[model samples]
Target: DRVQIINDGKFIFSDTIAGLNKQRQAFNLLCTLLAPPSVTSLQKISGVTAVETLSPSQFCLHYQPDLNPTAELLNLAVTQNWQLTELMPEQHSLEDVFMNIIQQEQESATVEQII
Candidate 1:
């Protein structure tokens, strides 16, 4: 569980993601029903935001948030059905991107050295 607040410790939102899979079918159903409404609502909030399906069981939300995307995504998912997965807020900075590239290069170099 995580909490975000704004101004004088007024709570904005809280998020929780379960690490276990208990009701798998319901989870699947929620995902199917979730996309359309989520896309619509998020777009209405921000025109530049977009929802992309990475695979049958994976989705990626690209939003330039004036509001917290994780909180919004969690709200949307729960209203559709009970869900317990981390709604990742995935807007990376330039430094993060470069760090990731550097990490990958280091890992590959280590592997090459081992080989």
Candidate 2:
């Protein structure tokens, strides 16, 4: 099905379900390691935009999809003996997309008001 998202009388997004699914700023990965690694070290990897520690041994990495760093991360995990236990991609639902678009629009409006 096709959907269009509007915010403040402006069209924020217009596309099909598949199209919306493909529109993501970054790819999010959840990784669980037996041994914890420094968050700063993970942030240094190319394509990695952000690193969030869910726990001492679990981390969420956000990176550009076009420059996926999964291979590099796996190699580093092996070399550092992090003992990677699990790696999974985060999937967003349609509701998540709608909320994100609305949040973005709100943020943009706030920026415009400030300026």
Candidate 3:
């Protein structure tokens, strides 16, 4: 059983997956359901794993639970410019950033259609 934080640490998620696809699935589940980063980054890390969506605002990740992978994932967060914690009160969350981008894109589309 692996435990992970989601949505800037607003919720905790857990689950388990079958062989070969376990580790990647866990991470992807967290990103997709909870706090999403860039889709490109998820695609890179998700690679070849299965994912299960939980509630509309949460997710449960299933992975092999490797001790070594913890550090590896941390490194990945750094390299990809992603934050893994929700402890700060002054910073925008990963999800907020993406949501703002989506909003901007939608607004731009609407304005263009009106022109």
Candidate 4:
């Protein structure tokens, strides 16, 4: 599994289910029972720009840097008494890490130039 953050503005998550049936089952359950409300609630969250289901087992959320939604979503699930499944925030890809660094540097340079 991998995630890429571009310009600190968009989040892209990718994974495969070729060898993972449990993940698929959980995902199906989430989608069937929790997805609609969760997605709706997430859409109402401030700074959330987009919500998308990338696959049966994967969903991606695009939000502002200030809003880290993992906790909120987990809390929502818990509060709603949904079974807690393994929801992981995968490590950012090396490429994404490098890009984020470069982007920060560029933004810093831009700020300096403006000043």
RMSD in angstroms between candidate 2 and the native structure over all alpha carbons? 4.0
Q: For candidate 1, lDDT tens digit of each residue in 1-115?
A: 6433232344322333231111111111122332344445544533236666655445655555344355555666677663435454343453454455456666876999999
Q: TM-score of the candidate numbered 3?
A: 0.28
Top-TM-score candidate index: 2
User: How would the candidate models be sorted by TM-score, starting from the highest?
Assistant: 2, 4, 1, 3
C-alpha lDDT of residue 101 in model 3:
44
Tens digits of per-residue lDDT, candidate 2, 1-115, equal 8979887788998898778877643498899999867899999988999999999899999998787889999999999999999998887876887888899888988999999
Model 2 TM-score relative to the real fold: 0.67
Clashes of 4: 0
TM-score of each: 0.38, 0.67, 0.28, 0.43
Models sorted by lDDT, best on top: 2, 4, 1, 3
Lowest summed lDDT across 10 adjacent residues in model 2 is found at: 17-26
Give the per-residue lDDT digits (tens) of candidate 3, residues 16-90: 433212323223324322344544443344332433444443333333434223444456667765655521112
Kindly report which residue stretches of model 3 are placed more than 4 angstroms away from their true locations once superposed: 1-35, 46-48, 51-60, 65-68, 86-115
Superposition error at 7 for model 2 (Å): 11
Model 2 CA lDDT for position 60:
95
Candidate 1: minimum summed lDDT over ten consecutive residues — where? 20-29
Candidate 2 residue pairs in clash (backbone atoms < 3 Å): none
Error of 1 at 81 (Å): 0.4
